[model samples]
Target: MGFRHTLRDDKLYFYERRDIMEQRHNYLKKIRQYRREDRPIVYLDETWANSHMAPERLWLDEQGRGGWKRPSGKGQRLIILHAGSETGWTPNADLVFRSKKNSTDYHDEMNSEHFLEWFQKLLVNIQPGSVIVLDNAPYHNSVVEKVPTKSSRKKEMQEWLTRKRIPFSDKDLKKDLFAKIQLSVPNRKLYATNEAAKACGHIVLRSPVAHCELNPIELVWADVKRYLKVHNKTFKLADLEQLVPDAFQSVTPEMWAKHCQHVQEEEERFWEKDGLQEESVEEYIIELGTEDDDDDIEVRDIEFEGEGEDSDGEQDECEPVMDENDRELLRSDAVSDA
Candidate 1:
């Protein structure tokens, strides 16, 4: 039996044994529909924390007329984590960043040199031209627009910022606010106009709406937060200043699989209760080239691992092909948001 407190009725409602089983049945059905796909599916999400010690006065107004107006101290840490299929994918692969001070003392949070480096490093390790479904984050949106364009560089194109009365500041333009503004800027389709078209190959496509459900990796984070809550631990901004990979070592593949299985089962039960059919999950596996499956375990291990592989085994079975025009359109993204 389970009991839940309701704010609407101002009373506690109790569920008998049958009620609990029925609720679980519905949840399991939902999970099966979401994770049952042949293509790879992953979920992405973000979390952040401000300075470790939040001043009490900062939360409460001194005048006793109002609540705390601003954060007491300066400092913040932001983290991004991605999870794929319940049984597969690595654990706690998080990208972390730290702020100099409090929320009000804003610095360049997005598109900074550091942010670019972090993204570039991640891209290098990913399968070239693999599809990476992401939300409408500013960093992913303005990559092409921010890149110097041919017309602007050659004085052949109109400086849109100048015509729009927008002052250009390499510094301010690099800030998060600039990204917010760029997201609203009309698509110019500059990827076609830029020289660095290959860069866009790293991003796959955007996920559909109401479809965090479609992302198999989303459950990894749901479990992560739950685990943290049980431990009663608060993250400190200073902790993020260190190499993030080390800090995240505590999250192992075994732990992630455990959580993934739990979430998958729970969701499946939910869908069944609702009498809904299960949706198939997408697989990331692609026939990137051919290799003899009979190769020794040592050869197979190297290819599967992030280590160097044998020359004969390294060639892709299906290398991505792109024409100049398509490359430009993809780089500029003037036509499609993907």
Candidate 2:
């Protein structure tokens, strides 16, 4: 046996659930198809920054005395929403405003109404027939017409079946009726964002759950945050506000192109990996349950913790690799921003 002792750290686990894998596969396939057709692919996401967002580590002299004295807390926060393509940030699509809550989770500060407003603004600025990539945030997936779940009253479920003409028996039990609903309307729920995109002749494609690396805007957020962490000295709300615009402007079109290319490569990797997995493993079918079923489903925004990490202390194979040229480009961009 060639086993060796290894230390385990608290790393995030990517639960390769059958349903999640299927979603990822289909998403990658559809995205590649759109690219083949030369459709403009736009990545949209939201992130938040606080006044006291500065570098976590700093140079220390022999005497350990080289660090800036920042504020006590993560001062007033700002929620930022934007969209971009390979060409760069969409003009007039940036939306930033002071957050009402100071929670660490940015999703708490966003809602369906606010997101729709910014999405409409983005639609107006971008060309028609563009493909918008979104993540599975609750706000982004707001249901236009909520389907009846197991928790719904029997009457409600019956009424829904009747309205949809699903041909459910009048004497069917609650569970039986729910099963009929699932079978009849497997993918019937319509998202408000999708409807909005359709009205503008644009298409909305959701990045698979827990797959933040698929969206290029996640990298853009990282770039903007890195700029803020390096340049933020005052750690004051007003100063942070002024620096925000400069931080975003530092992400040039070339950088956006690199990010998009990196994600495309990642998609290809997943496509290959999935093909191999399917050949080796037995086909898995996940049974669907009613909404009240307490399954271990993780619903989250694009900015999730420990993104692109695997729990087994191994680097994710799908992670984009940054070579020397990429590093130099980033360094030059930072220097120019300074």
Candidate 3:
């Protein structure tokens, strides 16, 4: 009875966290390298402005507790894509999409094509020697069709290898019996945004997964919500659309500077801490301060619902489905049978 075994708690995703830190270190090195070159770096991200979003309570006084009810309706929301940088917010580089619910019952969303269109604008307007920071969303990291992991290429795969100038051919190259051939090469040019950025004479920097603290835009979002909450009296979609522009415009350049500086400090802190997630972080306060998220407010995926056809505009995975033709090809036997 005295000899009882003790159970220990397991650390979930321990190895995964370490891998993420390793990624952080590598990215930080790249960032520092860019900084030394005097290349401007801008952090980019997308967020949803929901119609049902607003404050839930009031500051309670010793004399009385204050509570209020806000009107509700089926209001639409818009998905806005914005960017911020060290200098300040980029002028003439924000996109807004009317998010409507599609037949799939989800929300119409921003996919790779939409992002790429905006990204083209971003590249054009941004300064030379600039690094556009992004999360590891699939779209941002989209690249040319990677070589398939096969010994020989289909007509298309063969063409890709030739175009990429990868030296591997059943004719030009020989393989040992024990060894295998690989048409697919790792570390090849990433597709979509990465490839596009490089082609446009800009750099694409990606934040590590699970490291939200590294993006100043996250803090900017909190401020935007606080602004919306303060002015959101009637939860109407039309008003929300109008308020969104106001909310974003309300973000002063000083706030952007503070948030960006805070992100750099967080990067340094993360490095000093050797990748361990901090129990506490000194938060960057907005000019309007912050608001408490209502406990009843349901947190959904980033894309807000509107009235439209169902789509895979999921920002969570941020996967880009290049174009309609590409999508069809992937679905067809051309690539699948291969």
Worst 10 residues of 2 by lDDT: 282-291
Candidate 3, RMSD to the unseen true structure = 13.8
- TM-score for model 2? 0.73
* Count of clashes, each model: 43, 0, 11
State the lDDT at 145 in candidate 1.
40
Off by over 4 Å in 3: 1-16, 59-68, 71-75, 102-108, 149-181, 184-187, 275-338
Query: Which candidate order results from sorting by lDDT in descending order?
Result: 2, 3, 1
Alpha carbon deviation, residue 186, candidate 3 (Å)? 7.1
Q: Per-residue alpha-carbon lDDT of model 2 for 27-62, expressed as tens digits?
A: 776777778778899998877777887877789999
lDDT of 3 by residue, 1-338 (tens): 68655532111222134454556666666776677788888878876666666665677769876655555542456677788786667888888777865432222365566778899888877887788887654455444454333343355445666676765555543332112224345433445676677787887776654456777887887788779878877777778778877888788889998998998898777667665433322211111100222122221112212221112222322222234553454457345644
Q: Residue-wise lDDT of candidate 1 within 129-192, one digit each (tens)?
A: 4434443333333333442232233221224445556555544433433443455465433221
Give all candidates' CA lDDT scores.
0.37, 0.72, 0.59
lDDT of 2 at 166: 79
**Residue 91 lDDT in model 2?**
94
